[model samples]
Target: MNKSLITNLVAALLLVAGVLLNNTLLSLVGLFALSGGLTNWLAIHMLFEKVPGLVGSGVIPAQFEAFKNAIKTLMMEQFFTQANIDRFVSGQDSQVHLHLQPVIEKVDLSPSFDKLVDVIMNSSFGSMLSMFGGASALTPLKEPFVLNMKQSLIELTQQESFIELLKNQIDQPNVMAEIRAKSKKLLMPG
Candidate 1:
């Protein structure tokens, strides 16, 4: 078991023993046990509450909201952004196989491939070719496109900031808070 579980179990055991023994020494042990158990309970409670009757407690959630926000910001910036994957291009001079995996791990390549096929079919060249050709003519294009996308993603991941930003963002409150506090005086609405 983990340290917390072990400590909790020990506290419970001490409390039970102390209550059963019924003496001054046992009372002291009971107090120690109770303090541990109560403190742990209060700590857990404070995580989600403004503890109704407490004198000064239950500020964990509100006070650390920035910590939660920073985590959300990290998730959005690193794993849910289109810009992260779109930079990886390998097609023509400007076109690239933007890998969605970096930002969107859940990608359905078939739909995209099908959309490409539809676009090709709707094009003038595609219409002329299809008038005399078959759908099999475009089957060879799918794998190459997928492979190009893979290569582009590989290229983008090599950027140092891609992974570094995760740590940098986590550490931002410590580094940027001072700078932000100082810069705030510049905006006095004069």
Candidate 2:
């Protein structure tokens, strides 16, 4: 059985045996044990269960909502503060870099190549190009041009200089503050 039940049973038995044998010391000890056990049991019970005549029983259930709100407030104010978030982000190593090669590969540079062709056709070289196949002559260059452009962009972005520049931009006070604020808004929305 549970400790509370065992304690109460033992104490009650002690009290009955002591009284039947006319032993004052045993009786006193039994009375104290029984009173203490019952008192502790009642206290523990009162915390979780309401008693009709008790003023402040079942306090945990009664203030459950308040307790939840208090815990949320504590988490927000202490652990999820703006400074804490900023510190967490800032503490990361400078070597942390964003991998953009996959994104660059997915980019459609066809529009860019078309724009270039339009520029070339409208330029002073337009009349000379009309003598040949005109823009269609450049049409064959589209695939190669897009491929080369994407490769160049991927290389440029992967360069240490570009990574450093990007890191510096992100490390700017205004940028970091804005990032922290946005993260906070996302994490602790109303």
Can you write out model 2's per-residue Cα lDDT over 1-190, one digit (the tens) per residue?
A: 7988898889988898899999988888889999999999999999999999999999989998887778767776897666765555554634455889999999999999999999999998977898898999899999999999999999999898987787677778788778766656665567
TM-score, each model?
Answer: 0.31, 0.56
lDDT of each: 0.60, 0.84
How many clashes (backbone N, Cα, C below 3 Å) per candidate?
1, 0
Cα lDDT tens digits for candidate 1, 58-137: 66667676766676567655743444322322123354433435663344466677788788777877877686564567
Model 1 compared with the native: what TM-score? Answer: 0.31
Candidate 2's C-alpha runs over 4 A off are: 1-95
Off by over 4 Å in 1: 1-104, 122-133, 157-190
Best candidate according to TM-score: 2
Cα RMSD to the true fold for all candidates: 12.4, 10.4
Clash tally for model 2: 0
